[model samples]
Target chain A: MQGTVSVLTQIKEDAVATPVDRLVAATAPDMARVNELILSRAQSHVDMVPELARYLIDSGGKRLRPMLTVASAMLFGKGTGNAINFAAAVEFMHNATLLHDDVVDESDMRRGKPAARMIWGNKASILVGDFLLGQAFMMMVETGDIVSLGVLSSASAVMAEGEVLQLAKTGDVSTSPADYSEVIRAKTAVLFEAACQVGAISGGADTAGRQALSQYGLELGIAFQLVDDVLDYGGQAGTLGKNTGDDLREGKMTLPVILALAEGTAEERETITTALGDPDATADQVSAVVAIMNRYRALSRTLDQARVHARAAQRALEALPASDMQTLLADVVEYSVSRAY
Target chain B: MQGTVSVLTQIKEDAVATPVDRLVAATAPDMARVNELILSRAQSHVDMVPELARYLIDSGGKRLRPMLTVASAMLFGKGTGNAINFAAAVEFMHNATLLHDDVVDESDMRRGKPAARMIWGNKASILVGDFLLGQAFMMMVETGDIVSLGVLSSASAVMAEGEVLQLAKTGDVSTSPADYSEVIRAKTAVLFEAACQVGAISGGADTAGRQALSQYGLELGIAFQLVDDVLDYGGQAGTLGKNTGDDLREGKMTLPVILALAEGTAEERETITTALGDPDATADQVSAVVAIMNRYRALSRTLDQARVHARAAQRALEALPASDMQTLLADVVEYSVSRAY
Candidate 1:
């Protein structure tokens, strides 16, 4: 009983220490180069390209994706400078999607500020997103590694497909868990998979190590998104960097909504459908939906789902030769799910 | 007098022959492969990809850029098979821009059909445009020519910069002719230049031949856009596949508008500005603007500028060896400007 309590206390202590912090500290040297490359590449002879790009790039997001790329590269202890390029490319791709997503979703705010679209208008947002995408490909090509280029490019296409699929399923109550899985995989996990895989490639990881990192990224990304979906209904707005229930207001068919709808009673379904996609849904209605979700443990179930993937992510890391970087990556996966708890 | 009349008649007959038509006929065999590649590459496991893609790709915009790529490749007759891929990538880039352009312009029609956004909504249009861009890069990477990839990627960045610049300058009457030149060059000419350059690279053109084709494409693109600017004010909807005076209504600062603004009286400038970017500007207002433009010979002046570029395009080909394709290309430049006459 004493051992169990001590282990639980240790886990709680570790949870407070974010995996991203460790990842950042470990990869800080390369990440500085990545930041420089990102800023330099985002620039253009045309002033607006850099201005709108900097708005999103400098928004102070954790830069988690690029950190993953840099950390994955560090795992092999290979000093190929290509990781800096891949990290920049990954960051650019993520920012491009955010800019475009804000426009498509008519999102007024991102990262707790007026979106690029809100400041520059939708046309500028769309075009600047294209600029970042162009820059990303340019950086990848500069590495002169066609194989990594192929991986990133293919991920780019799949990410678009995933977004379109989600757009297609928006507001439809019949969206299956399987469909939700596909959406999250495409929209989130694929980039993570590509980011780490490209980093591994740049780091001179052999086929096995590359595949292992790819799996780790994929599972971690899935957990990350599942937790995001849960947080939308249950997390504080400050914690989320946006409104608490943006997914609900956007009519996004996230895992929490999917699972809740599957298990809710008819009256509870009515409560959710009434509020789902209602950009004007009141706080009272949100509270009511949360009540139902709690009664059915839907939020907990979503977190449970995230935990499964988080564990899988850690398992994938076991395939790599054990290192401090590997241990830190595994802990980050746990912290991803712990955000909900 | 008889000789002069005979020569004039011959020039008139040659002016009726379009360069695009000649190039199209010459490159018909290779273009079939390119068309096949375009159709195949546009497919996705996601159903919306093909539906939205085909809506714009099949709208019949002459596919002129892809034709330039194929014709440039055939200049060397090397048959490296990279031309088909380059041609498809060029076409995809063009179509992707058109999709996003329709959304940005809030255009109601394209190729005499309701815009894809009208049929599928803004969200679909934005996402599908992204898919096509992703597919374009995928095809470029598949060619395994990093040099050509760099060319297309840089062009992609410049094109987006141009569009954003245009967006920033939209509805601003003070936009300079120099600024207008930069906009058109970045927005339109860079793709044409990249398309032809990539084709030359793939076709194994000598340095002189490659530079010749690059110059030829850049000049030809400038001429093509100048003619388009003229046609926007003067051509019938049948020829334009869009309403005349769209530039004025959209507040676009095309050459005719810029020249007219430069030379017109204060009242004339006021008359143009009243209708400029006025979505409700009527046919009478359009006619009034055209009257002022004609009074100053702005339309004629615009066409003259186009002719300079067209002739320069032909001059660029003089650096290359004389071939049937070369003569046809020169004739096409003449035809490009002759449309106004």
Candidate 2:
């Protein structure tokens, strides 16, 4: 009882420091190595390969996925050093996907700056993406961990499939919530699942611990993506480094749009559809749609769904042995969801 | 003395049958399995994946890279069945490159049909290419052949770098023959080298046999690309199933362009430069450029360079144990260069 109370008190005190900050601090030395591996691996004799890769790699996104890998490995208190390679590979895979995604989505901005594709053109984006993926595999192979390589490679294929499906579903007003679930799972959660699983494997975890970490990562990823989708409509512009309503403009059938479509009146649905995929959709038009969404309590319901997944993520961590890292990981999941508020 | 005479006589007797025909017949059984594996691995729940993949796979480009893998493996007569997976993976990597190439080059025709990017947009081409590449690594990982995976993954990165280099050099009249060599080696030769090397490793080859096959494939690939570049200007339209002058229009600084730029008169240089990257350059303009190339013997010189590579390929194969497959592979090298004439 005293230990439990002490842990609770410590967590409450540490809440002032964001979970990500705490995780970053705890995993700082390991992450420095991962970051170094990532930058060095991204390098090539071809100047554009490094230049375009750096444009994206340096343009800030929270290195959250790789940090999860590092933290998961640290959770077991085993230091095999393979986790650094896995973490770097995970980041490479993520950046590769981003480079290609900007091309596929014809996105103009990423991480608050002009997309790499816009600067280097789509051809460079595609080839550099391939380079990074190749580098990712090379890093994994160098570690001699074929199992982790399989996890990461399989996750890569799933991510591409997800992108293709998302492309097919774009501007598709009839896209169901089920289809959306499949898209987000393949595109987002599987990498997280693999990242954590490989980290656990590198950390010398048992089968049960591996499974628990995998489940936790998957649930957290779902919650993370769900929050991202909601934030696209509701997030402050500076907060995300991307314009709000970009998803709606891209005709992405995200949860908010899907829910709003399901619950809106005929005229309201007409307004939503009109603004759904129109790139020239005005701020007034977006606000109008948001008003309709609010009227239907769509955004709140979506966040509610995110909370369910977040809770599931925390519940997954409960299966692991109690430790400060485990608790911090759970807190990270909570932080991921709370970003929406 | 009698044995040498008989072998020479047998080679003469076999000359009537084309080397590719003989090689195809010899490796038919192995290649069939490789083809089956390729088709199966290319399948996806997403309809577009299979549809687009098959469209390119079925379009006849001679499946040469995978065939090289199969033949190299057969040369050792040790059947681990791992060659089939490696062969399929080589094909996937090749196809993925083609898919992305069409998008990057903005090509209209591939193997006499419209490019995949034309039917499916650039986004599909990019995503499907990533999918195929993912499938390729997945196949390699499944074999647990980390050495071969390392080879292919490294080759994959080199290929991408070559492409980025080529993109940077496009339309640059200052591109040297050395630069051209670097481009072809990175883009084309490295994959050939890897395909054969991995096949040798899978077939239980020693270090020497592996090196011999790697050298053979590299030289053959260089010859193959040289002939390909020459054919873009000199071959009959239907023979190659692609229009001549594509490289010129696409601003590709192939050997002919570089040589013509080096040897042409000032006016000739002007004419070549003007038609170099002009997609809408008329047939007469292309004829004018070809006329300049003829005056400088640029096309013949390129083929001469190709023959040099072909001879090198045959020389490399001589280090291996003499077999019908070896003789047939050498003949294929001859056949590849002979296409330019």
Encode model 2's per-residue lDDT on B1-341: one tens digit a residue.
Answer: 23333544455577576777666666667788888888898898888989999999999488888888988887885434889999999999999999999999999889889999999888999999999999999999999999999999999989999999999999999999999999999999999999999989988889999999999999999999999998999652213323878999999999988999999989999999998898998777888888888888888888889999999999999988887678878989999988877
Off by over 4 Å in 1: A1-17, A235-242, B1-17, B78-80, B235-242
Off by over 4 Å in 2: A1-15, A235-242, B1-16, B78-80, B236-242
Clashes of each: 1, 0
Model 2, residue A275: displacement in angstroms?
Answer: 1.3
Q: Report per-candidate DockQ.
A: 0.69, 0.77
Say which candidate scores most in lDDT: 2
lDDT at A240 for candidate 1?
Answer: 30
Model 1's TM-score against the true structure:
0.93
Error of 1 at B333 (Å): 1.7
Q: Which window of 10 residues has the lowest lDDT sum in candidate 1 chain B?
A: B1-10
Candidate 1 pairs with clashing backbones: B19-B332
